[model samples]
Target: MTVAYVAVAVLLSIALVGSGIAKLTRADQVVTSLTGIGVPLGLFPFLATCEFAGAAGLLVGIWWPPLGIAAAIGVVLYFVGAVGAHLRKRDFGGLSAPVVLLLVSAAALVLRLLSR
Candidate 1:
């Protein structure tokens, strides 16, 4: 059971890292995409920073388990919101992927919580 939680944590970490990197490195692209969906361009950089910070926390946040958990929860919420944003824009290419990621991250957190 402990091993399962570890694996889930690793998976969620990777997902968070990937998403964070994408958002951080491609802020303009994200801004454009979100603009199409009616999201405010000014918020893109702030959101991107949050994503990056959350990912970093997941990767090296073992020193503060509660903080790590908070980061993971934020990522989960961000992904859930991403799915909603995509859906609102009729973007089929995005809806399922982030939802799956969100579920996996949340499941990982749950497993960790239970293992305690």
Candidate 2:
């Protein structure tokens, strides 16, 4: 169970850290996507920070379960908002990614809790 938890967390952290860096770097693709979604450009930095922090927390949580649990919870909430945003725009096409991430985060959270 611990190995499975670590594997999932590492995968999530890699994806999130990469995403956070892209947002911070203002990668053209990310900017374009955000614009299409009607997300405020100004919010990118803040969002990126949260992602980076969450990723860090997940990594750190390997040795400290509570932090990992908190990070997983945070990521779940963040993805929930992302899903809501896509829904508001009626972008069903954009729903899958967030929904998948939300599921992963939720699963990680549940695993973390059960570990305790």
Candidate 3:
């Protein structure tokens, strides 16, 4: 279970960091998707900060269960909001990524809890 948790945490951290970098760089697709969803471009930095923080927490959490648990919770909420945004805009076409990330976040949360 610990091994599983570690693997999931690492995978999630990589995903989050990659996403943060894209947001920070204002990748064309990210900009388009975010603006399409009505998210302000100015908020990109802040959003990236959240992703970076979450990734850091998840990585550090491998040694500290509580931090890892809190990070997982934060990440779950982040993706939940993302999912809601897509749904609110009725943008079903762009919903897959958020939904998949939400599921992955949930899995990380559950695994972290069980591992602890």
Least accurate 10 contiguous residues by lDDT in model 1: 56-65
Task: Assess candidate 2 and give its lDDT.
Answer: 0.87
User: TM-score per candidate, in order?
Assistant: 0.73, 0.93, 0.98
Candidate 3 residue-wise lDDT, 53-116, digit = tens: 9999989999999999999999999999999999999989889988988898899999999998
What tens digits encode model 2's per-residue C-alpha lDDT throughout 38-105?
A: 99889999999999988898888888999999999999999999999889888887788789989988
lDDT of 1 by residue, 57-93 (tens): 6555445567667777887788888888889889876
**Could you give the C-alpha RMSD of every candidate to the true structure, in order shown?**
2.7, 1.1, 0.5
TM-score of 2: 0.93
| List of clashing residue pairs for candidate 3 | none
The clash numbers for all candidates, in the given order, read: 0, 0, 0
Pitting candidate 2 against candidate 3, the one with the higher TM-score is 3
- How much is the lDDT of residue 8 in candidate 2? 82
Superposed Cα RMSD, model 3: 0.5
On a 0 to 100 scale, what is the lDDT of residue 53 in model 1? 76
